[model samples]
Target: MAATESLPVTGGRRLYVQLGITLVVLVAAGGMLAAHRATLDSGTDRLAAADGEWLLLACLAAVATWVCAAVAQQGAVAERLPAGRLVAAQFAACAANHLLPAGAGATVVNLRFLTRCGLSVRRSATALAVKAAVGGVVRCVLGVALLLASPGTVRLPARVPPALLVLVPVAVAAVVLAVALSARLRRAVGRGFADVREVHRSRARACALWGGSVAFALLHAGVVVAVVHALGLGLPTGRVVMAYLVASGAAALLPTPGGLGSLDAVLALALTAAGAPGPEAVSAVLGYRLLTGWLPMAPGLLVLALLSRRSAL
Candidate 1:
């Protein structure tokens, strides 16, 4: 009787947490609209002067991230999922991702959606772990390959800024410290090894998993590169992508919602270190965020709310 009684309490707490995150997401979207440029931290002013065509390209690439995410989600599990609902869930999950630090919102939304798709809770959790681990591996591989293929492409700035020097060591140390201290994280790693074996049992599923993760990372990198071009900055595409990969990877270590402030800070410094003008580097970061985060948020929110109402997620 006691064990059963505690179940409701645990579930109720989870429900409350989900509701709180959803509320925060909705409020953020509304706030962005209401405050416009001021709320967005001056990105809008810079974007207004950029080339319209390139901006549109960035927006389109942002939209494609949903498709890639859905594909990867399917690959994470052996069982097939409903295509439409899967896409919609990815959309909504990304919107929620912006509100919670370290992608907690996105993970919750995906986990709930997988459960709704007739998966056992443990199996659904395993699938999530598989996807996360695969995604990380794919990102690192791509970053390394790009660097090896284009040696000397990433030129240093005339002088390394203090911000770059400070941020780099701090981010690396933070990640190392977090890994060393967390027993739970160690447990998760053990589970993730099980995840890899399960996900690779089917060749097709492995392809989808790897392919989707690759496209997802590349598409996001493309958005950043396009933004640089749109701003009329002459930074090489290779350096722009490298900067994004490094900054985003570092920012991922910190628990900031969608890498909001952390990503912005690190990205600007990274771009500066890559020799972009300070103002243009800032504008490039802002432009990419607007395209990827702000622009698609409303539709994502709507999809999320509807999925919630229908118990689809």
Candidate 2:
């Protein structure tokens, strides 16, 4: 009895310790963000004279992004998720994603949530893989379509880097080698493919999965469009949408948590190429990030903590 009781106590201490370390890391990241306050403010200032109504619309679009994400998550699994809890988990995952590299935190939260909601570990994992694969394909296809339509929005450099050409094949080969070398990985891939087929076997599931994903990307782009209109940016709406889809698809290649710096840079450059002034482009990106990333972060974190306390994390 003593040993068992002591085990829980020790486990509690470890959880707290881990939480403290997470807080420390978050604070460090916050400090780094603060260091760029001047740059952020300069961009934000450019929106001072913008229309309030447009900004409100942008906020609405941002809200829709979260809802769409939740819908997509629910669609990923055949089992129905409790509506309220599923949405809350998605919100929390958004916040958690910012804290860890390559969306690891979000993955952990979702995996735990799915398991708690009565999914086996493998099934839960398969749902995530299916969702990711489908979403990636949708985003890439949409991005390519947009890019092809508005080629001028993305300008290529005069000369391709020789190193990049070599690096691409090397990276591809390395990934293949890793998969070939690992039996577990090969099994996982096979299982994921089977899961994908299972998910698409249902017409309703297929619709929800694809529909939610398209809405997620489009609504996010709509937020940017709203910002452009709010700030009276002369950039064409179609090109702005194109630029966002293309840049975001490319930025997804980076492993940064939520694609923080890489996404910002890519978005800014894309917006500029699309013919918005540098300051205005930066301002629009800042506003977009403010709505999607910063504003909801605190509440998302709180929800995450509450869920964790309930052992639903």
- For all predicted structures, in order, the TM-scores are 0.82, 0.88
Clashes of each: 0, 0
The TM-score measured for candidate 2 stands at 0.88
Tens-place lDDT per residue, model 1, 1-313, is 9999999999888778768866877888787566556646666677798998998899889989989999999999988999999999999999888877899989999999999999988889989878887888888998889878997866546899999999999999997788779998777766777777877888989999999999999999999988999999988888889998988899989998888889989999989988899988988988888778877788888889889867897
User: How good is model 1 by TM-score?
Assistant: 0.82
Reference-based lDDT, each prediction: 0.86, 0.84
Those runs of model 2 whose alpha carbons end farther than 4 Å from true positions after fitting are 3-22, 25-29, 147-178
RMSDs, each prediction? 5.4, 2.8
For model 2, residues 212-253, the per-residue Cα lDDT tens digits are 999999998999999999999878887888878877787678
lDDT, model 1, position 201: 86
lDDT of 1: 0.86
The most accurate candidate by TM-score is: 2
Candidate 1 residue spans exceeding 4 A from truth: 1-24, 31-41, 155-191
